[model samples]
Target: MRRALVLTDESARHPFRASLPPHVVRRANEVERMVPWRLKLGLTRKEAESVLATYAAGFVCTLAYFS
Candidate 1:
């Protein structure tokens, strides 16, 4: 986990991505609001992908979802 932190430290460059659970969920909500109703599924898709990536990278966020 410690190693992951160093790997995902690029968060500064990407505010949407953070190292906290609450922040991740918060960003997720923000992301949800950003997507249009017609593209609602995007959030679910991004959440699954981001959650997997987050765990893989050792962080706990998915700010990219809001993108």
Candidate 2:
């Protein structure tokens, strides 16, 4: 996703970028990459819910770091 962002300069110039520092965006991207995509496809409903919670927690933690 980092590579994609670099390739697409339009997105890089988004107004939100002014508020969210580059470091914060990079940290969030790293957290996103940590999610188990293949494993998620095979998970049961309950298991998927847990995984979603974990993903959300990671994103929250990343944002919390900026605070």
lDDT scores for all predictions? 0.55, 0.69
lDDT of 2 at 43: 75
Residues 1-67, candidate 1: write the lDDT tens digits.
Answer: 3543423334345654544445454566564337675366556767778877879775423545554
- Cα lDDT of candidate 2 equals 0.69
In the range 1-67, model 2's lDDT, one tens digit per residue, is 3533333234456766545656777776664546677575777779888988999999999999999
- After best superposition, candidate 2 residue 53: deviation in angstroms? 0.1
- Score candidate 2 by TM-score against the native: 0.37
> What are the clashing pairs of model 1?
16-63
Which regions in candidate 2 have their CA more than 4 angstroms from the true location? 1-40
lDDT for model 1, please.
0.55
Winning candidate number (TM-score): 2
Error of 1 at 24 (Å): 42
Worst lDDT 10-window in candidate 2: 1-10
